[model samples]
Target: MTEKQPQARVMIVDDQPMVLEKLRLVLGAHSDIVLHVASRAEEAVEAARSFRPTVILQDLIMPGIDGYELLARYREAEELAHVPVVILSAHDDAVAKERCFLLGANDYLVKLPETIELVARIRYHSGACISRTERDQAFHLLMVSQRELAAANVLLAKLNGIDELTGVGNRRSFDAAMAAEWSRAQRQSKPLSLVMCDIDLFKRYNDAFGHVAGDFCIKRIAAALTEQLRRPSDKLSRYGGEEFAIILPDTDQAGALLVAEGCRMRVEGLAQGESSSGLRSPVTMSFGVASLSPTRDSDMTAMVEAADAALFEAKRSGRNAVRHAMEMRAGQRLNA
Candidate 1:
C-alpha cells in the first residue's frame, strides 16, 4: 500500500470576512493542506501559535497592528522563526513591495488581480515552503542512519575472529594475542606461561557417540576452562579441534602448573562419556605447561613448540595428567 503525504498547516490573517472565506474555499481541498483564518492581527498571532503553521498569509493594512508589526513579532519568536510569510496588499506600488521585503515578507500579492492568480500564488509559495521542510528532515534521518551502520561494521569485524560455538577466541585470535603479549612481557622482564590442553582419546569418543555429541563435549570443556582464568590478563582460546591454549601473563612455572591442574580436574569431573584410550577410564584432559622469562629476542613459535612437546610426553606417559616443559627437557638429557 502507498503511504499518504504529511499535511501542511497554513494561517490566513485578514480584516475582511469575505477575503478569509474566499481563501479557505480555494486552498481547503488541496492535498495535505489545512487552512486557518483570523480576522485581526492579534488573533493571527494566537492562531499561529496554536496551529503551528508552515506558512502565514498576512494582510498589509489591519486595525490593531499592521502587517509589518505582525511580521516583526513573528520573527522574534524562536519557535515561529522558520515559518514563511506572504503579504497581501491593496497598494501595488514599488515602495510598498520594497518595504514589505525588508520586513521579512517572503512574497507579495496584490488584491486587484484575478482570484485565480491570487489562489495560484498562495498554492505555489506554500508548497515550496513545505517541500523545503521535508528535505531538511530527510537529511537529518540519513545522517543518523549512517552513524548506526558504521557502528555495526565495527562489531561485525570483531566477531570475524571469534569462535561461534565456544564463545572463546579462535586460532587466529590466539596467535595475535600471543604476539602482542610476548613483546609486553619481554619489556617488563616478567615471566610468560602457556598451557596446551588436549581431550584424551577424543577421536574414540567421537566414534562411539556422534560428531554432534563431540561438539557438545568440546563446548562444555571450553566453558570449564574459562572459569579457571579469573585474572584480567589471563587469555584462553580454542587452538584447534579438541585442543585449547591459555596465555598466563606474569605467571611462573609453579603458577602455570596449578592453573593447568585446575582445568584437568574440572574436565575429569564432567565425564560426559567413556573413553576408549586405555590410560584414562573416563573422558578427561591432558595438559602441558611451559614457562619462560622472554627476552627481546625471544620467538613465540619456539614457546609454542616447547609446550606441544610437553603435551606429547603427557599423552605417552599416561593420559589425564600434567607435564612441565622444563621437566621434559631435563629428562631428555638424562636419557642421553
Candidate 2:
C-alpha cells in the first residue's frame, strides 16, 4: 500500500488586507495545504512558532517593523530556524531581492504568481525542510549510540582482565603487567620484585571446612595480603587456586623480603578473625621473594623461576615461612 504524504503548512505575512485575503482564498482552495495569515510583521514570528508552518510566505515590505527584521527574527528563533521562507514582494527590484536573500529568505517571487507555480514551490520546500529535520535527528541519535557503544567496550575490556571471585587482578592481568613493568624497569635500570605466596595445606583446610568456607578463607587471605602492600606501585593478583603474586616496581631485595614477611604475618592473623566467624583452623601462607635490577642479559623467565624455586624451598622447610630467592647467599632468611 502507498503511504499518503503529509499536508503542507503555509503561513502568509503581509500588511495589506487585499493581499492577505487573496493569499487566503488561493491557499485555502487546496485540500492538502494548511494556511495561516499574520497582517503585522511584529506578530509573524509568534504566529509562525505557534502554527509551526513548513513554508513561510512573507512580504518584503510591511508597515511597522519591516520584513527584513521579521525574516532575521524568524531565522534567529531555533524552532523556526530551518523552516523555508519565500519572499513575495510587489517591487521586483534586484537590490531588494538580494537584501531578502541575505536576510535568509529561501525563495522570492513577484506579486501575483501562477497558482500551479506557487503550490509546487510551497510543496517542494515543505518536503525538503521536513527531510532535513528528520536527517538531523537521526544523525544526533547515531552519535549518541556510538558514544555509548565505545563506553561499553571500554568497560568490557576492563572486566575481562579482572578476577570474578575476588575482585582483584587475574593471572592474565598479572602477565600483562609483569611484561610492561619488566620492560620499564630494565629501561630505567630500576629493580623489580615478585612475591609469590600460597595458602599452606589448602586441601586439608577445604576438607575440614566445606568448599563454601574454603572460598571464604581464600577471600579473607587475599584481603589481608592486599593490606600489607602499602604503595600504589604494588599489584596483587590471584595466580592460582590458592596462590597469589605481588609485583613491586622500583623495589630492592631487602624491601621485597620485608613485604613478603608482612604479608605472611597478615595472613597468620586471619586465624583469629576467622574464629569470630566460627572457623577454628588457623591459616598461614608460604612466601617466595625475588628481586633484581635487570641487565641486558637478564630475562623475565629467570625472575619467575627464581621466585618459584624459593617458593618450593619455603614449602619444603615448613608451610608458614618466608624465603628470599637469594637468602642462601645473602643470609636474609625470615622464618615465623
Model 1 lDDT-worst window of ten: 327-336
lDDT of 1: 0.81
Tens-digit per-residue lDDT, 1-336, candidate 1: 886655667788999988877777777767666888888798777778888887788899999898888998888887677688888888887998888888778888786456667556666666777787788789889988898888988877668767888988899889988988888888898888999999999999888778877887788889889989989889889999999999999999999999999999877876544343222225788998888778755667777887887898899999899998853232131121
Compared with the true structure, model 1 gives a TM-score of 0.66
Candidate 2 accuracy as lDDT: 0.86
Kindly list the per-residue Cα lDDT of model 2 for residues 182-283, writing each as its tens digit. 899889989899998999999999999889989988888888888898989799999989999999999998999999998998778776655663445888
For each candidate, how many residue pairs have backbone atoms clashing (under 3 Å)?
Answer: 0, 0
- In model 1, state the lDDT of residue 193: 94
Name the runs in model 1 displaced over 4 angstroms: 1-17, 25-53, 56-135, 272-282, 327-336
Off by over 4 Å in 2: 1-54, 58-79, 87-105, 108-112, 205-209, 270-282, 327-336
Q: For each candidate, C-alpha RMSD in Å?
A: 8.1, 5.4
| Highest-scoring model, lDDT | 2
